[model samples]
Target: MAPQLDPGDLVVRAQRGEPRAVARLISLVENAGPQLRDVAAALAPHTGRAQVVGLTGSPGVGKSTSTSALVGALRKQGKRVGVLAVDPSSPFSGGALLGDRVRMQEHATDDGVFIRSMATRGHLGGLAWSTPQALRVLDAAGCDVVLIETVGVGQSEIDVVSLADTTIVLLAPGMGDGVQAAKAGILEIADVFVVNKADRDGADQTVRDLKYMISLGDRRSPDGAAWTPPILKTVAARGEGVEDVVAAIDSHRDWIDRSGERDRRRLQRAESEIQAITLEQVRARLGDVGGSAALPELAKRVVAGELDPYRAADELIAAVGSG
Candidate 1:
């Protein structure tokens, strides 16, 4: 069991490379305990340095393999890496079902790497609600790079876009990843596209398809300036072309840094994080929004034909404001 470290102690231990403390901090975030605000305050100054990359795609698209291979490549460069993998919820435990640790067993003994699995717990966009908080923990822990691999829940996995500096959309050959990417709105979010399992048939076609999509302006730039995303082929299973993928990622990072896009992205990320936190706080104060005592009473009034729903909403809003 992790020692009972308070928010301050946890931050200090994590900064000193104590993985247990880091994991515990993330656990506190996931549980949405009161300590989180204090933890966030303590972590705020130490963050804003780690290069957070997001990995997302449909299931069976070699996402985990590509992630492990990328980690190996990143480690070879002597980078301290943190991996936050979001997994599907387990029915009974409400924890990560396919535990990412099992897929990334190769790095279990590596001191330079830290991996944690989080259950999505039915949150949409394939991200756990506490992801950004967990990210801050890893960033403050001095990880030079942090990879956020989200749940592969097909097209709705766009939440990573707001959380990562560089988002990699992985797809295997013959999986219709290209077609699915467009349909699922991934085309708008990917910073780098990786055709994993490149040795398989239709790999070239997949690359071509992505190129065609990119040429059609499937990607977005807030400045209206274009960034032609590189479509790299990789055999992540065998480590082939993994370096090229890393090189592409590095290239994108460098571009973002030079083009002043990195800061902009972080600013947007902060805005979104703050907005989400505010909404969560408001809900907590209002006692779960829809399940509040005021809400049920208003429901009763509405059902009894004594008050209209619109008026009830006004009353509920007043109650929330008072609370």
Candidate 2:
């Protein structure tokens, strides 16, 4: 028989930068292990210190390469980085199909960097269901910065904005991404835009298109302060123009801090997380009610027009609350 794991011991080792312990904690989160509540309680105090940056875009836009390059750049400045690369789930194994851990082999030996490839498991919004909890694990594991690279599921990939402190939208030239971005509503979420593969033809035109689109939108902070998203060009494969991208991120961070937008965003994020958990628990309680005769009895009453759905729903909620 396998031994039971201790959440407090695992958290202590993880905070000491033990990679195995960190990985174990993340695995526990991903699997929704029995000790999840205890682990979360143990990890709560050490979190909220890591700066989370999310990179997202359509496929073929080089998000992984750009993420790898950004990791290298951040490492140069002596930052401990953690990468949560959300990949499409494999049909057979239900694991990450395009494993970023393999693609980012350059940083495999770097102890300052920790990378994990997560399968989306058919979840929408281009991120795995466990991503936020996994992010908390990395944050509590002493990482200075955590980068979340989404699965590049275009049009439905905006959920990263809720989880990240800063969101970077990457685009490549000759892909019609500028107009597509506007249509897909990514222009509103991007704090920094990178026209990657700049050495290719039509790179300048792409930048111009992005700039024109930006001019059409209201790029203001909540406090009415003007904050324009910078359209920078980069050839991430060659590591060119990456430093400028880092500089832009730093500038955006400063702006959000000064404008009090960071607190607002984090508050919204926390509210969303809490709401999701409460809804999930309510759903579980409903499942329990369904197993009893209460749901069927209510359904019969509703079918016979003896009870209205609203009141039935209210009664069901009351039952759930009591249970």
Candidate 3:
């Protein structure tokens, strides 16, 4: 068996901006290690400080490039940054296929930046299953900002809006993203819209299309305050227009905080996190009940048409609760 880790020590080191400690803690979270609960408890007090910004778009929208440029901009302001790039999983090895760290090698040696690429590993909604816990690790590790780049899967990827303080949706000039964005209901979730590769043809029309769409949407906060998302053009490869994007993010953050939407959103995020954890625990309990001959008998009864699936599910929950 592996040696037990000292969660307190790790938490302390991570708060001091020790990358290895932060990475180790995130690894424990990803693997669902026995020490995870202890580590989370140790790090809880230091969290809730980092501003999480999520960048998501369909594939080939320069999300990685934009993320790297934004990191550079934030670092210029002397803020420590963390990036979690969620990549599609490789079918063969179940590892992050894109290895975004390689794409962001420019900041690989920067002490103020911590970049990690996590595989979706069959998890839906364009994120790794442990992303929230990993965000906590970075937040507690003294990062002023944490950027989450999703796997860029269409439609289902809107889950990023739940975790990010500000959500940026990127579109390219020729990708027909304006239509896709509407179909995906992304207009509702986006806090900032970026037209990347602005140097390309049709960039002007893309901007115009986005502007027209935004004009029709009711972009308001729960407090009845309006938040018109700023649409900007960028050539991320050249780092042009990134500063404007960053400014828009800062502006949206201020708006959310001032309107009390930040607190409301965080509360909702916590509720979702709690529900997910509770379900996972219940799932584990159901597994235990399944192994104890309960599941096989239920299956047999259902197969014989003596019991409906819904009744079997109710019985399974009761067995899990008792077990």
Candidate 4:
């Protein structure tokens, strides 16, 4: 079959590392029309090559700048990088309110880097619904490292951890970020903790507090393996201390690889993505029901007190055949 929205050209161009083609492919993923199935099938073989890292934190923690710095660092190592800055969605428009591209303009002209901002769009974990698929697009387009920088919605940042091979939680001095991180359950999910703005008054104190907090709890890896989440400091504005953070991330990656935890985490992520996509398809299929009297009758009976909601829902499910 012919490709969607192309003279059979966009995916080919994207495979060649054309930024415009990559952006268009991501747009198709975000919109996710019927054509996405074709796109996915075509791109499947080229994916699974990129190392995915997630950067998340509360507001004012310098996630955007750190993301930019990471991109630069990775590029300096002769690797291609892609960034997805997930922004808060507007309630009225369901679109990104702030794109964060301004913070990353230093790499705008670099062909080795691709940066985009996405809207949370009311997704539960402060990430875009299409992020996983968008990630595959970046991976297929030849990014060695793909960074998913999520909205700074405190605890909901856990969603990023679920998707990433390595999750970095950024903190700042004087904000009680350590305590807030504990409250957000980040200590449970984070593979690395970053203290950005390290030149500030409470930088060392913040790092100390984080170390103490981790010491107070178990720093064991997810599968009873012995691995610790490192606490690193970064002054992202001056691009200070970011290389150490990157090195820490690389070390964690190496550890996970040696421990076989990387394969396990990727499998879990794939399972979750399958379940989510199935639910989405089921909901969409339900809306396309043409000759469905069981639904309307069940609703009427429930409203008239002829049947209970649970019973009506069961009948509706039976009628829909698990749609």
> CA lDDT, every prediction?
0.79, 0.82, 0.83, 0.77
lDDT of 1 by residue, 52-106 (tens): 9998887777777778888999999999999887744311122433554464666
Q: List the residue pairs that clash in candidate 3.
A: none
Q: List candidate 1 stretches off by more than 4 Å.
A: 1-3, 88-103, 122-126, 151-156, 218-224, 288-308
lDDT of 2 by residue, 183-291 (tens): 7788888999999999999999999999988898887668898789999999997999999999999998988889888888888888877887788779879989988
Write candidate 4's Cα lDDT for 212-289 as tens digits.
988888755566777778999898878899899889989999988988888988998888888877777666555554
Write down the RMSD of all candidates, one decimal each: 3.7, 3.0, 3.4, 4.0
Q: How should the candidates be ordered by TM-score, best one leading?
A: 2, 3, 4, 1
Over 1-323, each residue of candidate 3 has an lDDT whose tens digit, in order, gives 64666989988998888888888888888777788899889889998999999988877787887888999999999999998877443111124335544547778789899988765554553253478889999999999999988744553445554689999999999899999888887877889999999999999999999999999988667879999999999999789999999899999999999998888889999888888788878988888888888999999999999999999999998887777
For TM-score, candidate 3 versus 4, the one ahead is 3
Task: Report the candidate with higher TM-score, 1 versus 4.
Answer: 4
lDDT of 2 at 277: 76
Clashing pairs in 2: none
* Position 293, candidate 4: lDDT: 58
Off by over 4 Å in 2: 89-103, 122-128, 152-156
